[model samples]
Target chain A: MDWQAIRLSLWLATLTTVSLLVLGLPLAYWLATSRRRWKFLVEAVVAMPLVLPPTVLGFYLLMAMGPRSPFGRAWESLFGRTLPFSFEGLLLASVLYSLPFMIQPLAAAFAAVDRGLVEASWCLGESRLRTFLRVIAPLSWAGILTGVVLSFAHTLGEFGVVLMVGGNLPGRTRTVSIAIYDQVQAMDYAPAARTAALLLGVSFLVLTFTYALRRRQRKPWTLI
Target chain B: MDAHLTPSPQLLADAERRYRGGPTVEARFDIPEPGFSVTVLFGPSGSGKTTALRLLAGLERADRGSIRFGGATWSDAARGLHCPPQARNLGFLPQAYSLFPHLSVSANLGYGLASLSARERRARVDELLALLDLRDLEARHPGELSGGQQQRVALGRALARKPALLLLDEPLSALDRPSQVRLRKELRSLLRTLDIPTVLVTHDRAEALQLGDRLVVMDQGRVCQCGDIQQVFDRPTDPAVATILGVETVVRGRIESIVGGMATLSVGSARIFAADPGGLGWEVFICIRGEDVAVERGSTPGSGSTARNRLPARITALNPEGSLVRLSLDCGFPLESLVTRQACADLGLSEGDGVCAVLKAAAVHLIPHD
Candidate 1:
């Protein structure tokens, strides 16, 4: 029973999901609605995580957050702590690694909104921000929730990025997956099985929720 | 030109728009004294009618030219000026009613009044609910309402801001045919009571005729004609306008001779006289509305002073259209008459019957074919 690791992983996942929601909303909306000629270029960059190997992402992140890097020095100066091998670094890595999970669903949902409604909103003298809050946000809550759940699940089960950014430290940086690996390495099969089983159950339940929300939202009547 | 001497038109637009690599739509028209007028942009599908409406609504940018409304420049491509739809001071009803599915009817109606206090918003929404007769559906989401109800909510939402102009794109197109037929008159009456200058875009000929006071007929991305609805219908500028207006009978006629001001044109084996709308040379296309054509039993043919051409013809087809049956006739040239079903029954007319097809010479309109 690695209570500390489990708590750390849950906290990190929660923070990462919240941060992604705040950051990903505008980014996904821009990707969905922008008519700029370079829109596809931005879309490609956002989707890079979906195709890039997790290990390769972890390696670059590790270099970027290293002591010699500008980001690492800025972070150390601000927070008075080095970024690598810390929980904050692990949180940053999880957000980067799990970005597509949050953005893809939100962007798809935004693009699915009827363009006529947006135009009608403007015709009624509503500004762009008011229209989004009153019309678009209400229509897209299901997709937003799905994105939140997927990003949370994705951050929870991460292994390579967490290991590269936050090395083994039981309470501060070590996560449940790392705890399971440690248990297995020490030949403690019983505890490792318990932890792995819990993680698997949680992941399955999260996915079930996401699919259920999506299935209900896909009914045409619910939109038009 | 002193600015005070000539107060500019309420709306003066001469603009062109191109979508991707598709056809470029060009339009030029002005509305003076538009307090209670309905100017319709009418054409067949792909005739750039909706594009013209969108340009006026500021939902689209013109590739070139300008749009001036109420002394303000809304769009001028040469000056790199484009006003957004939010600033256009217009209401628009897109083809799909596009009511917000998640908001209740009252909330959707009040969606545009964010600048108002909550009390004022509620009052306005309540007023619209009564105006559109949507009081019962106020609490229902759009998904829960019928198509007609959804349309009213969408209209109410657009009217919430009291826009200077109303733009509707195929306002009744989202409904089934029966609903559309039933609502056409109702919608026209409603627009009249709204007391707003409006520009409507529709491809349906009946919808165009019933709803508009002024008509701007477009074809293949150009404004072919613009005038009073009846005038344009009676005197379309060209063959393309004739076709778009759904003139029930259009036939090529070569001039046999000119007597006084009447040109007797030989169409097939039948000769019809039309007032010489001269300078059409010897070739012209004759356009006649089905409603203008009259038919009766051939045996009781009376010498009537009104109708000039009374040809004894055989019925070719009878297609039932709503309250009327369209009688397609073979009077040496194909002709069509719209008669009530009761008349159709009383005359005992069917697929093959002999009847007198009567036409007033004034009902015949001529336009140059070339």
Candidate 2:
């Protein structure tokens, strides 16, 4: 069943989800609350992954992180490694590829918070940051959960971005999706079927848990 | 409502803010004098009533003007200075009592005491819990409480910081009719005990009359009149103010003569007397509240009813307004009288019936109009 590939996928998805959490939350908050006139442009850029083909995104990501590129050279000088084919590179690619999955739900949740609560907090001498942490963050638990689940699930199932950014390498960048493809190509149909079944079961369980959580909400959060 | 403390509006403001695709709301609050009492920002919907309160709270920025609260200059457009609500140190109850959904009653009350020590905060929260009469529901969340309970919790939370002034926007509008009326009395007495200068926003005239010591009448995004509550409600300055004040009957009248401080005005085919507004223009708008007009039989001109201007008229319409019945009459011109259903039954009044509309000479207010 390519258990090594499965483990690697899990690790990549975990790191990618964490990285997106650190990066996406503030960005999502800003996107949700900012009143800037040109904020739509930033929103569009963040949402690009939703519409752009994975292969197209991967192509640009590879170019931006190539050995000859400025970012690639800077990374080599600091981390002493190229960014195109390592685990770190795959993690970064996954984070970018699943950006919208994390951000859209988070932004929607933040925006959906009752504005009256925010104003009340301010009136009570609480700063904006305190209000966000105390009032907004707690109410937005559902969105955060949805973003985490979607990002992790999407990164785990990614095939095209992984193929373009992280070339197949055993114990390094060969994620479960790549392993499944490799098994099918090598005529290892039984193992491919076993791996595919495991993925289907996991996906089904994750979706069921998510829907149950949403349905049980006393106050319904956004469907997304 | 009380002389509990030396409270002052201590606030002065002349601000203007232009809304997108709407008229500019110009709030001119000049309560430069001292002593605490309730001041209501009274107006109809879209009349900038809430904006006026928000201007004082530092929530709504003025496009051109300044606000001085206490001794500090809160906002000045020319100087490019504006204070945030957090620094304003004011308790603000928004139209909706938005108690934090996730927090319990105690936590909601303690939200503003972040700077206080843990023990002090707890004490303050407890004080509020008792003051607002929510000790039993301290552990409950806002959703677990009823409408009135949630309102008290919200009020407790706002007062946790002991703000200098309280600004409430339609504090009772969110509740059901019964709770709203009940809370209306409770809130008034509560504010009286607290003794802080308050600026409340409400479109309901009954609320204004019941809660406010002073009233600021607003219309079309401007202050039409500001004075004592009873005075403003009884004698609005102009037709616009009179209409916004809900002065039920306003008819065009010409001053025919003035004698002994009483002015005789002629309407379509009837004559009436009002306290002279001497030289307040010959063209006048006569404003009379329905409650001030009493209904009697047409034959009872000198019956014990002492309202001076008892004009003989025919009933036009009868509409029920809560416990009272409003009788529309064609007494020379249109007029309205609010009487009990029992009074209607006693008089056996109905549409097309002749009746005497009794109005006091002082009840008729004259506003000069072009």
Candidate 3:
């Protein structure tokens, strides 16, 4: 029943979801439309985290966030501290770990969009940026919704990455999954059950709501 | 390159593209790949006709070709220059009638006019609505409209910008017969008035023949022939061109006689004369327009008058050609002539009707098939 850990976990997951979307959308769009030879390479790298253990990604991220590494040193110089064991650190780790979940569905959805529609918009003299905002984004809402919800839920359940990078610091880095472990280790079964139930209920409700909204927006031709 | 060699305004206005290499498909035209006042890429489907249209639109990059449009190098693969579709300033009505379903008719029309003033945009949209006969449906959403209506809206949207070049990729393919005819007529008049170089891709030969000022016959990703409609129709470059142009029927017979610019050739018991002569005793493919053959109820052949190429034939089949009827007749040879339903009704025509098929010998063109 540690409130700070629960609050921190929620914050980390939310921040990760938001940042992932911001970064993933453009990347997905590029990957979806690109004919470059390196596009496959880029896709393969994005998909690496899906197959690789979360701890492996977390280990690299941990090293990358430490003050000894170049990126970590630059960050330290900017912020006056190491990023590990911080909420921002957890967000970055979760974003990377959950990237494919957010991007794949979105990219698939965006790709599924009738290319004729895109070409039509271009022929209408709408800029690519405007077309994406007005046509691609609105039409691909279902896939995007699925991607966002999946990323958020996956980030919420994220364990190995947060444990390795965020370092289970109560009131700062300790998320609900880590908090549940701590409760059970201390033989506090009741609070662990409560937290586990909370995670399950919240994730289920969010996913259900997102799916319902998608169904509502579904066109008759989209039934298949 | 000399400074004088750089294209002038008139040169740009009459841009021509001659692409070679790559998967050899025959399109040999000197046309600006972009910014044409009316450059129609006309041929049957799978004829590389669509590719030619796309090249002009700057949608598909050519493998090895130079495209100059309105004094700009749209694409020159050998020179490693390719202008993207955005820079082409083209109005393309792609197949599937890619109307913005989210936007209403007016909004869809106004989308391309963003570069213009508000008043200009409004005026343009209004003019298009009137021109397309869509003034009454401005408020309707694309999804709510019929396929024909959506097509018109798409055409309106494309025309709203008044692009330097217009590319129509089988825009009328999805419409009903009536709608197709209506739009075809409207499109011809509209294109003429706008004077924007247009490239129309279609599989419908009649549509191409009617709409294209100069038809470019393409096959297997190449242009087989390119010329004015009559030139191409009268004398196709090859048998393939003849086939694509739907002029494949040719009668091989020695010239028995020639009279008044028409040569009579004896094929089997029936005599077929040239509507337009090739040469005396020269083997020829007698090209006859399907509409030129008229059916009669009686076996008595019509006396040769101004209308020539008369034959005593049996009605083999009747095929519908929109409002008209096309009769496939056994004129002692496998040949078909297209005529209207009103004509058939007036003649009381039917299957197995023994009739003398009246045709003008002048309509029977002689082209070298081999």
Off by over 4 Å in 1: A212-224, B2-4, B248-357, B360-370
Candidate 3 C-alpha lDDT tens digits along A1-224: 77887787778778888898899889999988897987999999999989999889999999899888999999989988789988788888888899999999999988988888898777676678877887788788888888988998898898999899988887888988999999999999999999999989998899889878887864422211
Candidate 3, residue B325: Cα displacement in angstroms equals 28
Clash total of candidate 1: 0
List, residue by residue over A1-224, the lDDT tens digit for candidate 1: 89889999999999999999999988998888998999888888878888998888988998999888999889889989988898888988999999989999999988888988888888888788777776676678788888999899888888888887788987989999999999999999999999999999989988887787677763332222
Docking class of 3: acceptable
Better of 1 and 2 by lDDT: 2
Q: Quote the lDDT for B191 in model 3.
A: 79
In what order do the candidates fall by lDDT, top score first? 2, 1, 3
- What ranges in model 3 sit over 4 Å off? A218-224, B1-28, B31-38, B117-120, B248-370
Residues B1-370, candidate 1, lDDT per residue (tens digit)? 6887977889999999986778999767878765778898998888888889889988888889999998899999999999999898888888888887777899889987878999999999999999999998899888899888888888888899998888888888888887876676677778787787889888876667666778899888999999887678656777578667888776667888888888888998999878885555576667788999889887365864677788889998998989999888999888889999999999788888988898888898876532
Least accurate 10 contiguous residues by lDDT in model 2 chain B:
B1-10
* TM-score of candidate 1's A chain against the true A chain: 0.93
- Please report the interface RMSD of model 1 to 1 decimal: 3.2
Per-prediction TM-score, chain B alone = 0.70, 0.69, 0.64
List model 2 lDDT by residue over B251-346, tens digit each: 667888888998998987999999984445576767788899988787466867557798999998998878899888998788878899988988
Worst 10 residues of 1 chain A by lDDT: A215-224
